[model samples]
Target: MSTTNEAALSLAGVDKIYALNSRKPVHAVQALDLDVRKGEIVALLGSSGCGKTSTLRMIAGFESVTRGSITLAGRRIETLAPARRGVAMAFEGYSLYPPLTVRDNIAFALKSARINATEVDKAVKEMAALVEIESILDRYPTSISGGQQQRASLARALVRPADLYLLDEPMGQLEPRLRALLRGRLKRLLNERGMTSIFVTHDQTEANALADRVAVMEGGVLQQMANQTELKERPANLYVATFIGEPPMNVFDAKVEIGERVRFIVKDGPALDFSATAFSQAARVAIARRARAVIGVRPHDIRLGAGDNAAKVVSNQWLGDQSHLALDVAGKLMVAVAFDQVNASRGEIMRYEVSSTKLHVFDADSGEAVSHGAEAA
Candidate 1:
């Protein structure tokens, strides 16, 4: 997190609403408060209709802010026209001028900045090459493929000099290999130029690969914002705990029983018993205060071979680099990942272990996190 003085963009309690003539208004964004540091890259990450796109539009001045303020480069920009906001944006729809060549489209903003024609041409070519659209520079937008047009759109927005850049699914149309290649190049370009940017992406890999930090949104609200590792290891709540992980975190409803030893009894399932020394005093106190909790364990943390718990193997798949096992633990499905292949058959009994140090406890009622591992959240 950057200090207020170092922030390049800030949204304070921003909201966006669409009024209906004869019905209740739709709140697209709700009290969004975010800050992007100078030279930092952030990703707005969420599923479709989670307010991620609406938040981007509001920041770019395409949608009106229904409440609160927007500050960019030390100026209030909520009420400013898009052009006056000093923000360059790449649209997911590829809003390129159909009549113009790709070269001219990329040069449009540079021309507006009063750069000479020679410099504009040079800048356009560099950006086009970076996005792998150099060969299509002479082609019109209407004649180019969707992927090519998307690159052209990206080139146009990135070629311009601005205080900030907002990219909406910038390389979504590109194939996997190309998308991965461009992600590296784009990251380098942003770093070399010290460009402060915020990109919208529903793809978790894209967000993790490109951004310094990721903001996860859902139901018109911001769930959590942090770097990739923090988002994985210390998710703020249940929504983020399940949303950020691969294969998702395996969660089970349980009641915490405090005694000589701490025990988490799964609802009509197995009991996870642990010594009192396994958890910190604060973690024990927090767990004791809750009537019920949802315990989460990552797939990778479930150890196979031997332990107190017995599970029936449902299925096992060796996915080239790793093995994924689906097991039925006391009637509950639990997925586990292993680096080595497991010679187990369906319906076979297997011993597994879930250490208390690998547990994440959440308040069952409010869905808020209570503790992670041995520490209180």
Candidate 2:
């Protein structure tokens, strides 16, 4: 909440709907509302075609909204030309003029701001150094590495006297390690300059690492907005819960009376609530609501107990740091995480243990979480 207005850029009830040649209409962004506070990084995240790009473009003044308004530092800019929006943008496609040197390109923004030539030179030099492109400042865009060229493109965006910075999949084409490295550096640059930014990315991990808050969208509709902890632990809806975590949230179904404590019953498997009273009053109220509420527990929080590896581990997706185990239980899926010695094989029955507090409960009908006790009650 603090971040939105503090954000240099914001979209207040912004809407974008497209009407094809003669067919029906497709809503690109549905009454979307968001704020990218000054000095804060907000990530607009969603699957492909889920409006993440559309939303970013609108803020950059690249796309016009069919309805709703756009505001930057309290001034409306929805109908303004992209060049007059006072917003800097770095997107997947390079907008750099190939003939210009890195220094010249970085100075382009300052020139447009009516800054004097002397000051433009100083700002361009500073921005070039910040993005590690100073060495290539004199080189033509065609001569630089893709990464360096992109860095220059980014530096150019930063040189501008804009209220907000919009990054639309700016790292989309970079290698993984480089992407990770740039993400940290880019975030630092924004902070050092005290600039507000709205970053769009489909990678949840990236969003988690870079943003002060993340906004999740699906089918042109925003699902939720929150910090990393809230997004991962207290997702408002099932999609947010499932979309934010890596190896994802291990889930199972159970039904119990309110105030009753019971580990989800697994046929011949270790109980998630295997340790009695280790559970909580809220969890009981949660399970009873569903007649079968889904129990979601993160992988790292679970383990194959002693004799716990007895249940058959039917499916496993190994990804270096951890392995995702999918065990079959009474014709349902029971996922778990094994850290140290992952010696179990597929269909090899294994035992598991889950922390009571770590278990997440969700409504069966709405797919939203039945968390916070009151909802469960």
Candidate 3:
């Protein structure tokens, strides 16, 4: 395990296992390694049952680490009590005191530290304004909407000074518009304060918009961790490529054919030819060995009008600024996003071109990206 001298939070080979009653132990987290720098925000991103919440719980000391270690500011903290670690957490459940007004709720943490009345008042006011809940300051938790309650909880977490902050689905209860609004505000606030923070969310938009880096997790395992640009342009594997995109990348089984120009033929669908120099040595070797491979392309990377691959439009959905076209190519379903008006209708056969410059080749068996645009020369 590597030690980060200045990391605000570090997890080295961390594991969380639940010993069941008369059954096998469940490994909820497995040998996870991650580092978050001081004053940097990193998002723990993945789908449900991916161990994101379990990892957060372990960090907060609500769950025990079965093995390995966690450190905060160079101090080992996996064994520390939740409060002893100086970390503030806001959860999806508001966890607000129902009898208390918003102001009192936000002031609770500060008051617990025996801060003076004047200081508490000033801090509470600033936090309410920051979370844009000043108008609801005097309202009891039970009387306010879920969004309002979430803001109050967030403010409570933010009002107190702490070495680190953890927010688990803080905006999960809000409507889309409200979530977007709070996401922007929360991101800017965290940046301005320079608070070391970890945001746990399943929403990709939330992760991409807010965090400096994102750690993608899967069933009890860390898949990949990288900045948004790296994840998009150079995904570590097929799962990252498929899971990180909005509409998701289109992937289909393909065979590489040796020719003057290497050709990729999608099973029963389409074929694209790339110059020999366009392929990397690894890809060339894979092709020569007849290793199973797949071709992936983002929807926006497919050109609508002309190519060797002919597809029939299954459906077209007009979404204002753009349209989504569901196409059937040789009985396989494929999708493309058209920015301009598409002149085809359902059942209309059309020839389409894929941006050969933007192709992603993956080893079918291992599901890892082998090359980009066949590693363009």
Candidate 4:
């Protein structure tokens, strides 16, 4: 890991607990340390109610920390007011004032910053053009497309010079096609501006696409935080494994042999053997115990065979560029990414093959990766 950061923002041992005395006191965030370097976009990704939102709120000073500190450009800002921290935020639910015109909405932050009137006007016009909303400056939020309105909201946050940007699911209001289009634009905007951004979203695809680094959170705890390639190639644990991929990594019980002709023992069936290296007797025994060694492989790693054997098709979902086929490999559903056309049907028995080298093995006992050293990659 390159331990260098001309860091724009850093968090060390941060925690947050809301309504401490209440029966349902939410342990929203805990013991988190992260660094966002200059010109990078980092994502706090997880399902709803995970620490992603709470962490962003804490960083933005909208929520008080139960413990730890936040620093901006090397200055501790935990106790600073949100505005004093030089932070800007765009959120879900479209927080723009409905009555204000697009131009006025984008200019609100300039007014709050006490910028000169002429400069604020100039800034407003520039922002309007940047967001492609110059033609709709007089239009109210109700009159513009939700996509345009989201850009207006985004433009509003960019009006003032700030140390960090906190975006909480800003694309939730737009349609799918527009969301995709805006995602690319948003990425380019942040990259070109060299902004330190923390974006919160549960959308895995968006998180994967936009972040320079991904911080995976779950149930108020961080599961893993690393570059996209590292997280996918070497997951820290099963939680991170299941959360980061599209259609998800396929997981099923199996045992691995660390010897010649390595064997994969799936419950209630014969062992699928593959050869070469890496697998020890001790490792195999350990994997067998979680009474279930989890074998997780990505969709593209599974090969669709021409005949019925140990697998059968369950469903074929036509996902634009590719047809994703789900199959019943024993009881666990296995998926295949047919790079070409898919013409399979339910209950049709077919031969299925797993790319053993591309397989992911987990300790059935702890749900952690088993092969370490050279095998882990």
Q: Pick the candidate with the highest TM-score.
A: 1
Clashing residue pairs for model 3: none
RMSD per prediction, one decimal? 1.7, 3.6, 2.9, 3.3
**lDDT (10s digit) by residue, model 2, range 238-313:** 7787787876775655553443345455344434443435545555545554565666777676656553334567
Cα displacement (angstroms), candidate 4, residue 169, comes to 0.9
lDDT of 1 by residue, 144-167 (tens): 999999999999999998999999
User: For each candidate, what TM-score against the reference?
Assistant: 0.97, 0.85, 0.94, 0.88
lDDT of 3: 0.85
Question: On residues 123-148, what C-alpha lDDT tens digit does candidate 4 reach at each position?
Answer: 88877776667899888999888778
By lDDT, the candidates rank as 1, 3, 4, 2
Candidate 3 per-residue C-alpha lDDT over 173-234 given as tens digits, one digit per residue, 9 for 90 to 100: 78888788888888888888888889899999999988989999998899899899889878
Model 1 Cα RMSD, 1 decimal: 1.7
How many clashing residue pairs are found in candidate 1?
0
263 Cα displacement, candidate 4 (Å): 2.2
Where is model 4 more than 4 Å wrong at Cα? 1-4, 142-147, 256-259, 276-292, 306-309, 317-320, 342-345, 372-374
Model 1 stretches with alpha carbons more than 4 Å out: 1-5, 20-22
lDDT of model 3, residue 200 = 90
Model 3 stretches astray by more than 4 angstroms: 1-5, 20-22, 286-290
